[model samples]
Structure formats: structure tokens, C-alpha cells
Target: MTDIPLSTWAAMAEIIGAGSIITGLLVVLFQIRQFRVQQRNAVAINLAQTFYSPDLAQALSLMQNVPDGISLAEIRARGPEYEQAAITVCTSFETMGLLVHEKIAPMGLVLDLAGGIVSTMSRKLARWQEDLREEQQQPSWGEWFEWLGDQARAIKHEQPPAHIRLDQGAGGS
Candidate 1:
């Protein structure tokens, strides 16, 4: 076989090196995506455990006055033991738009679930409240109350009335 030219050998080496680097980068990206999915799952398990984890609730309660935005450091300050997990959970929650953060504190994190729930409930309650307002605007003694008499009868379905004694209260015919 003919000896390969030095330039050709060098070009082959470069191609091999570039291919390895690209392959390594793709592996790293895949690993990162897997890590994120695991982290999200962890957060979900932690959320479910919140019902039984008094510490979690206690820590979360500290966030009541956390203002419209906050940071991870603030969460860490609540309890040192859970700081790492808290930061991960908080960051995920923020990304999910479940919590809002005004300024990204160097270590800042804030849950925006309140914004979501409030907005949703506000719209729903507004409709209910509007119905209430419309009802109030009607003249007093609306037809709707006519159902009250039937409701009272249902409540008294069994036997004689408790308040009124038939033998004593009613005059014999």
C-alpha cells in the first residue's frame, strides 16, 4: 500500500476529533434533559408529601409575606437542611409559571401559583358575584324564595312537628 500523505493523515485526525466532541456534546445534552425530568418528578413527590410533611408546610408558610417576588436564598433561610431541594423545586415551579418572581435574585426564587389561582378564581368568583349582584338588584321577595316553603316541608317530613305539639297547640275540631 502507498504511504498516506501527512496532510491527509492530519485531516483524518481532525475529523475524528471533531466527531468525538460532537458525540460527547450530544450525550451531555441528553443527560441534562434526563436530569431535568427527574428533578421535576422529585418536585412532584415532594409536593404530595407536603400533606404529611409538617416541616414543608411550615417552611412554605413563611412565604406568605414573601411579596410579589422572592428568591431561593429567602427559601434557604427558612431551613438549611432542605435548601438544595428547595432551590431546585422553587426554580422548577417558577419555570412552570406556577409561581412568579419579579427580579431573579442572585439566589432568588418565588412561587407564582398564587397569581395563577387568584386569576382563575377571580374570574370564576366574579361571574358568581355578578349573579349575586343581579339577584340583589331585583325587587325584594323574589320568586326564588318560593322554593323555601318546599325546603321547609322536606325538613319536616318525619312524624309531627317538633316545635308545635298537635294535642296542646291545635284546638280540637
Candidate 2:
């Protein structure tokens, strides 16, 4: 066999080196995408856990009887427990709202999970939230919670309930 020229060998080596670099970069890009998906899934799981925690469940149970447009004074008049329940609910929604707003959690997932509850609770606590904000002189108080509630309400209006949406057996096995 004839010997290869040095210049030709150098060109072939450069092509191989470039191909290796491109392959490594593609691998890195894929890994980055996978990492992002894992991170988002982890966040979603944590949010779900928080939503279903015993404390939140208990708070929701307590607040279930709260009338729509309940006032802060009325909540305080009922007892400290009611007020505490309201705080728990508001803070939980606030966290969820912040997460959604920051895009750390997707809106579709959050709304699918707790949109109804958020809308209902927000309506029930609207007055109380406003009163608390005024009383505390903190305009940002419960801001995210209200935002989340608004988002939930808007989505609720725009889409049918899940049962209805799934009535067509879109995901039936």
C-alpha cells in the first residue's frame, strides 16, 4: 500500500477531532435538557407533597366552612384557630403562586392540581386578605396568593372541568 501524505493525515485528524467535539457538545446538550426535566419534576413533586400535607389538609378542613367574603374581624371573632387556618391556606397558596410565577413550576400542572381550591379559597378570603394587608401596611401581603387565585379563576372560566374534558375518553386506557 502507498503511504499517506502528512498533509492528508493532518486533515483527516482535524476532521476526527472536530467530529469528536461536536459529539461531546451534543451529549452535553442532551444531559442539560435531561437535568432540567428532572429538576422540574422534582419541584412538581415537592409542590404536590406540600399541597397534600396533613397540616394543609387540616387547615383546609377547618376553612371549608368559612363563608365567602369573610372578614378578618369575623375570622378573629370566631377564634384564633380560624385565623390560623386562614394563614396556613394563604401562605400555602402564596408559595404555589410564587413558584408558578417564577416558572419553577408549570402553570398547567399547578392549576390542574389545585385550581378549584385556590379560586374558592381566594374568594372566601378576599376581604380578609385586603383587611390584613391594610392592617399590616404591607401592600405585598398575600399578593402572590391573590395572583394565583386570579390565574385559577381565569383558567377555570376558560376551560371545562377535568371530568367534562375527559368525558370523551381522551386518555382512557
Candidate 3:
């Protein structure tokens, strides 16, 4: 066989080097995507755990009886248990809000998981939350929770409910 020219060999070497670099970059990109998916999965699992916790379940059960637009004073008047229930619901949603804000959890996942509950609870607790901010002298109190509620409301308005979407044969709502 004839020997290859040095220039041709150099070109082939450059091509191989470039291919290797591209392959490395692709691997890195894939790894980054996988890491993000893993992170989201972890967040989802944590959220599910929180949702199923006894405290949250009890809080939700208690809050179901609370009327919309109930004031902080009204909650206090009911009993310590009512106040505790409100606090538990708020704190749980607050954590979820922070997670959504930080991109640790996707908004779509949150909306699908707890959109209606967030929307309803946010409305029910709006006055109480506002009063809490004033009483605590901290304007940022429950800010993320409010933000999350807003997101949930907006998505609720823009999209159909899961039952309707699912009936249409869509895999996800």
C-alpha cells in the first residue's frame, strides 16, 4: 500500500481530535440533563412525602372546614388547633413555592400535583397571610407562597382541568 502524505495524516488527526472534543461535549451535556432530571425527581418525591405526612393531611383536613377570606383574628378565635392548621398549610405551600421559584421543581409538575389545592388555599388564606405580614413586620413573609398561588391560578385559567384533558386522550394535562 502507498504511504499517506503527512498533510493528509495531519488533517485526519485534526478531524479525530475534533470528533473527540465534540463527543466529550455531548457526554457532558447529556450528563447535565440527567442530573437535572434526577434533581426534579428528588423534588417530586420530597413533595409527595410532604403531602402524605400526617401533619399536612391533618392541616388540610382542618382547613377544609375554614371559610374563604377568613381573617387571622377569626382563625385565632376558633382555637389554637385552627391556627396551627393554618400555619402548617402555609409552611408547606411556602416550601413548595421556594422549590418552584428556585427551579428545583418545575411549575408544570406543581400545577399538575396541587394546582387546585393551591389556588383554593391561597384564596382562603389571603387575608390571614396579609395580616401575618403586617403583624410580623415582614413584608416578604409568604411571598413565595403567594407567587406560587398566582402561578397556579394563571395556569388554571389557561388550561383545562386534568379530567377534561385526560378525556381528550392527552397523556398529560
Candidate 4:
């Protein structure tokens, strides 16, 4: 047998509206997180495809077979075949670095895929890369390769790789 005051009704409406706004914001944040996860997964899939490409596979094979710190002169003596393989591998790592910097690709996944490969290649090619930089008179060249190596070294992992964990997520990442 009582009627609520007009101001009380208005206050109640305001509280309900605030709750609704908070709920909406929460939803937006969740969706953004999910979108990032999906993007990371897509990037990982794209990376896998890149790895399986004929040229890339060949380049990777060459990289693995090459001894650490192999001299530029030796690589040149082996001829353009080795040169082309190094080019392919380094360029690929450069692209991966860009993706990681842009956050389009997950850092963890990038490291997981071939962290050691990149690190080792970058180290092996350090002298050659510097030579190219001097030859071109552009010190900025191959910065991406170095950047990717640094990113890879910065990540710490134990047991299975991060990509495996991402793939095994309850949902499709």
C-alpha cells in the first residue's frame, strides 16, 4: 500500500542503465580478446603454409644443413644455389619479424615454429648481413632479421612448444 517517489524511480532507472552499460563494455572486451585469439590462430595457420611451400622447404633444408657461423666466402664458393637458399630463409624471417612487431602474429607461436632456426641463421649470417649493409650503404637492411632473432631469444619455453598449446586450446584458439 505505498507508491515509490518519482526521484526514487528515476534513480532506479539510472542504476539499471549503468549496469547495462557495464555489461555491454564487458561483452566488448571479451569479444576483442576472442578476436585477438582468432587472429593469432590464423597467423599460425598461414605460417604453417609458408613452411610447407616448396621454395621455403628447400631453403629450410639448406639452412639446417649449413654449419653454424659458415663463412660468406664458403657460401659464395658453393655458388648461387646456396645464396638463393640463404636469401629465401632470411627474407622469410624478416617477414615474420614484421608480423610479430605488428602483433598480427603471436610472438609465442613465431618463436615456437623456428625460434632456434632463426636465431642460428641470424647468427651465422651476421657477417654477411653486415657486408650487404655496407655494400648497399644502408645499415637499416636486415634489421628485421635481427629483430626477429631478438624476439625469439626473449621468449622462454619448457616442454611442448607454445604453438602446440595454442592449437590444443579447448576452442579453435
Candidate 5:
């Protein structure tokens, strides 16, 4: 200690300071990566809801209202408005082998699963934003509203076209 001069002490302090800066930068990078992954997962779940869930709901609704003995032709005739989206949905389900009653059983189950995914993602995002707010010591209202706007945009952009006319008008056009 006696041999060390004031210059050495200054240099040591600078090194420690630089080390801390590097550590902070690394933490920021890790956090950014984690956020990106979360956002991607959310987007993917949203895409699934857009492309699959609505159609599944419509199909299920149609199946429920149709008399067990009704002809497909009659059903189609009654559902002319839904022809395009319905056909697309039917084809998509057929390709995925999900159109069969035995396979799909309860469409509600599929919708419930999708809903759970969306709910979980929402909770995670809220928690993340809450943490960010706490860390930054700032109110989160603005960020929350912005996030909501983004979600609305995503839903608006991705929602499938209305299809499958329910006799009771269960599926809104």
C-alpha cells in the first residue's frame, strides 16, 4: 500500500467504473432481448387468434344451430354471405385435419386454449410494463395506453373476415 501512488488509485477507480458501465450495458442488452422474445410470442399468439380462433368459433356456432339432419346445400344457401370466409375456414381446418367432429369435439376447448394464451400474454406484458415503471419511477399510464393501442391495431389488422352465418345471429358481421 505504501508503494502505490495516487495515480495508481485513480487508475484503479477508473477500471472499476468502466467495469460497472460494461455490466450495466450487458444488463440492458439482456433485458432488450427478453422483451423482444416476449413481444414475438405475443404477436404469434395474436396471429393464431386472428387466423384460427374466429373461424373455429363460427364453425362451432354453425354446427350447433344446424338441425342434425339439415342438408349442406340448404345450409350453404342460407349462409351465402359467409361463403368466402367459410370456405377458407373449412379448407384450412380440412388441411389441418381439425374439421372432423371427432377431432375437434368442442370448439370451445380450442377457443378457451387460445383465450388462455392471450390472457397469459396480456398478464405478462402488464407485469413487465409495471416493473419498468417501477424501475424508472414513472407512472405507467402512457405506456399502458400505447400498448393497448398497439394491441388494437394488431387485432384490427389481423382479424379474419366474418363468415358462417349463425341462425340466431351469434356471430356478429
Candidate 6:
């Protein structure tokens, strides 16, 4: 101990401090990388799950059969199946919109899955929503539906969807 001067102790302390700083920085970098990997995994899992949902498939089928610009009365006359299918589609899109808006899910991913149908249905159902809102005395009942449609529309501006090639073999377009 007598051989070591105060200067040596001070130098040792500085080296220790520098080492700690470097270690802390490394830990932070590692954590960031871990978070990104988790996010990618999350996106992959969600994509697979959502794509395989029976409700989504049923909804798409209903959308194809249901004519555009039909009134709520027509849907009611068509019976519960029609109403249920439309509601299921809207509800799914609404949840998707909320997820994207809240950053719980990536917008591009959600759009890739259902953007076209979501936008079309929102437009088709605008009148129904308006009437329903008036009946309930709440104007915000289906705001998320509109938001999702609007966001999808904005994306169209960046890169026109028509440019996206559809593969008939894959059942696209």
C-alpha cells in the first residue's frame, strides 16, 4: 500500500468509471437490439394469426356477395347473416385501426392485410354509420372505421395501390 501513491489510486478510479460507462452503453445497445427482434417476431405472429382468422375469411366472402351502397334496411331484410358479416368486418377493421393508431401494430402490416376492403367498406357504410350515429345521439360510434379508411387512403397517395401487382394465382386483387 505504501508503494502505491494517491495518483495511482485516482488513475484506477478513472479507469473504473470509464469501464462502467462503456458497460452501460453496451447494455443499452443490446437492449435496443433485443426490442427490435421482439418487434419483428410480434409482427410475424400477428400476421399469421390475423390472416388465418375465420372471421376475416367469412367477412371477405360476405363483402363479395353484398352489393355496394346497400342501405341498413336492405341488410336487415337479408337477415342476420348479412348484418353479422358486415359488423364483423367493421369491428375487425376498427380494432386494426386502433392498434395502428396506438402503435400496438405496424400500420403498413395492417394495411397490407386489409386496407382495400377496409377502405371500401367504410365508404359503403358511411351512410349507415351516419344514420346509426343519429339514432344513438353519439357521433363518434364508428370514428375508428373512418380513421382507418382515411389512413389507408393517405397511403394510396404515397404509392398508388394500382401499382401493386396482383397475382391471380395467389387470389390477390
Best by lDDT: 2
Candidate 6 weakest lDDT stretch, 10 residues: 160-169
**lDDT tens digits by residue: candidate 1, 1-173:** 56999899999999999999999999999999999777656654553453455653553444333443333344346566444433332333333332112222111111211223222222222332334337567432212221222222343444344345466555554
Per-residue error for 7 in candidate 1, Å, reads 0.8
What is model 4's C-alpha RMSD? Answer: 5.6
**TM-score of candidate 3 versus the correct structure, residues matched by position:** 0.90
RMSD (Cα, Å) of model 3: 2.7
For candidate 6, what is the lDDT? 0.77
| Clashes per candidate (backbone, < 3 Å) | 9, 0, 0, 0, 0, 0
Worst 10 residues of 4 by lDDT: 153-162
What clash count does candidate 5 reach? 0
TM-scores vs. true structure, each candidate: 0.34, 0.94, 0.90, 0.76, 0.35, 0.79
Sort the candidates on TM-score, descending order: 2, 3, 6, 4, 5, 1
Q: Tens-digit lDDT track for model 2 on 74-142?
A: 999999989999999999999999999999999998998899999999999999999999999999999
**Cα deviation of 41 in candidate 2 (Å)?**
1.0
* Model 2 lDDT-worst window of ten: 164-173
lDDT of each: 0.41, 0.94, 0.90, 0.80, 0.46, 0.77
Collision pairs in model 3: none
Question: For residues 125-145, could you state the per-residue lDDT of candidate 6 as single tens digits?
Answer: 766667667878989877888
lDDT of 5 at 150: 40
Q: Stretches of candidate 4 above 4 Å error?
A: 71-73, 150-173
Lowest lDDT 10-residue stretch of candidate 1: 104-113
> CA shift at 15, candidate 1, in angstroms?
0.4
Per-residue CA lDDT of candidate 3, range 113-146, in tens?
8999999898899999999899999999888888
Model 5 alpha-carbon miss at residue 159, Å:
28
Ranking by lDDT: 2, 3, 4, 6, 5, 1
Point to the candidate with the largest TM-score.
Answer: 2
